[model samples]
Target: MSTTVEKIKNIEDEMAKTQKNKATSFHLGQLKAKLAKLKRELLAGPTGSGGGSGGAGFDVARTGVASVGFIGFPSVGKSTLLNKLTGTHSEAADYEFTTLTTVPGVIMYKGAKIQMLDLPGIIEGAKDGKGRGKQVIAVARTCNLIFIVLDVNKPLAHKRIIEKELEGFGIRINKAPPNIVFKKKEKGGVNITNTVPLTHLDNDEIRAVMGEYRITSADIAFRCDATVDDLIDILEAPSRRYIPVVYVLNKIDSISIEELDILSRIPNAVPISSENNWNLDELLEVMWQKLNLVRVYTKPKGRLPDYEQPVVLRSSGCTVEDFCNQIHKSLVEDFKVAVVYGQSVKHQPQQVGLSHVLMDEDVITILKR
Candidate 1:
């Protein structure tokens, strides 16, 4: 029996040979959908493995408001950088694959306890179960932020390989989910609406994805110029995660100043010498910015707002209702109204309800019924 990886390879080979045109669009869409399903199956693990975590023996207890996972080829100073950033000793050495498990650490920055994970090094074919790469990447998918560590001495093409590994596992780095809204109906026979002209996909391609998923009745609305893969992603949304990634260029001290200047131009990259602890502060700043956390301060009815400790919330989950729920589940039930004072509201502090969206650094006072 061919393994899931083998099956995926065969499909990829077929896709490479198939040319893309009007005649082949439907076939290409079918192939892409099949490839997505196969990859999900591969990530789901083999039969009877009893799926729990990504892989056995490395899933650690999660902590802090957000987690950052490190991924790189062997010996790219991931452990050294982790130790320097978090003061947690994760066996650092000059050899490859020195750290074999998920090493967890915590660093308090800007009143937020951020968890940092030092994952094992992955090779070229890591996505296909090479040297615990699948497990490492799996752990990384759950993290709020990912630091792709790279050795300055190595070829920059290594970055693309790591990206491909993550992409094959359905991890979209530094990307937002496609603006395609999907809904299922009991009797509708595949209705599609688009606000903007789709340059990359047509109704036939979208229908091909929906047909492959056996979704005979549904409504899909495309808001952006999305491709067939984007439509398939929405159909297989459970298997995908839109994650933020920061490229950490390690060991800058090994290269000359001219070489360093060239490496700095890479987008979303932070050049640092992990061994020498250079530019560590900037990395933390970039990390905090990418995390996009909202820190809401609670102000008592007649007292000043508490700035020392904050009720930190993810930007996506920082609504007034979410804030109340975070404080206490029953608080929302007993709430009369919430008075907000900050940039979220205009002019003055206004009375808002549970549905009000809270912004970062917003101050709020809840009045009970």
Candidate 2:
């Protein structure tokens, strides 16, 4: 039996040689699904692995609410940025692979304790279990946000290569999951339906992917103009993560004015000189927006709202109950209405229940029963 990497290469080679057209749609879809499964198996296998958070010395006590991971080719100023921004020093050097483990740091940005990780620099073919790249990428997968730190002087293709590596490890950077509802049932017989016209996918391709996974019964509802890859992503949802990424173009002080202008044009990219601490404010601002964090102020009974330290919550689940639970586990069980005052509520100081969602800078006073 060939190694998993060799098997993956074979499938990829076959896929590359196969012509993509309506005549070969089913074959291509099946091949794609097989390729996806092989990659997933490769990541899950014990090939010098890091069990998610990180392996061995690389793991750190996860501090803060959300984590931001630094990933890129070696010596891209990840350590320098981590040290400068958070005042926590990681090893920095002139040579490559200076940082060998995950250096954890924290910064209080907009009242949210955002954890920043200076991860070990990953080389090309990282996803194929090369060196300690597997563990590095595994840590990155768990991050809420990833910073693709790149040397401004390096070739732009570096960005593409990093993206490809992350994608291979089932990290969907800066992309949302497909708006397709896919559910597996015992005897539904693979029903496929669509709300909008799908220009990139057909029933044949969908059936082929499902067949490759041995999924005989499923209900797939497509709400967007999805592609075959989107279908595969939905099928491989367990391993996939939809993460937001910001391309950090480092060493901009060495680049020309025109070159800096060009690098700024890249969407979701921030160009800065980490050594000189230039344009870092903009980077943090952009990071704040991408984080989508909400700050809720606590207004004690018959007292003014506390602005010194607001309770931080992510927009994904920023409910009154979540706020209560964050402060104290027993607070939610009191079962009282919460008085709120902020943009989230329609009126000033409106009374809401535990289920009411909180917003940024919202003032809340939990009234006991």
The candidate that achieves the highest lDDT relative to the unseen native structure: 2
Q: Which stretches of candidate 2 lie over 4 Å from their true place?
A: 47-53
**Model 2: C-alpha RMSD to truth?**
1.5
Over the full model, what C-alpha lDDT does candidate 1 score relative to the true structure? 0.88
Model 1 lDDT tens row, 1-369: 998889999999999999888888888888899889888887778663312366665799888889999989889999999999999999999888899899999999888888999999988887777778778888888899999999887748989999999988788988899998999999969888899999999777776777888889988888999998888888878878899999999999999999999999999999999899899999999998999998899999999999998888976557899999888989999999999988889857999989989888889999999
Looking at model 1, report the run of 10 residues with the lowest lDDT sum.
48-57
**RMSD of each candidate?**
2.0, 1.5
Question: Per-residue lDDT tens digits of candidate 2, residues 1-369?
Answer: 899899999999999999989999999998899999888888887753433646787777888989999998998899999999999979899899899889999999877899999999998899997878888988888888999999999838899899999999999988989999998999959988899999998888998998899999988899999999999998888889999999999999998999999889999999999999999999999998888889989999999999989899876557988998889988988857999998888999799998898878899999988
Q: Which regions of candidate 1 deviate over 4 angstroms?
A: 47-52
**Could you tell me every candidate's TM-score relative to the true structure?**
0.94, 0.97
Tell me how far the alpha carbon of residue 114 in candidate 1 is from the true structure, in angstroms, after superposition. 1.0
Clashes of each: 0, 0
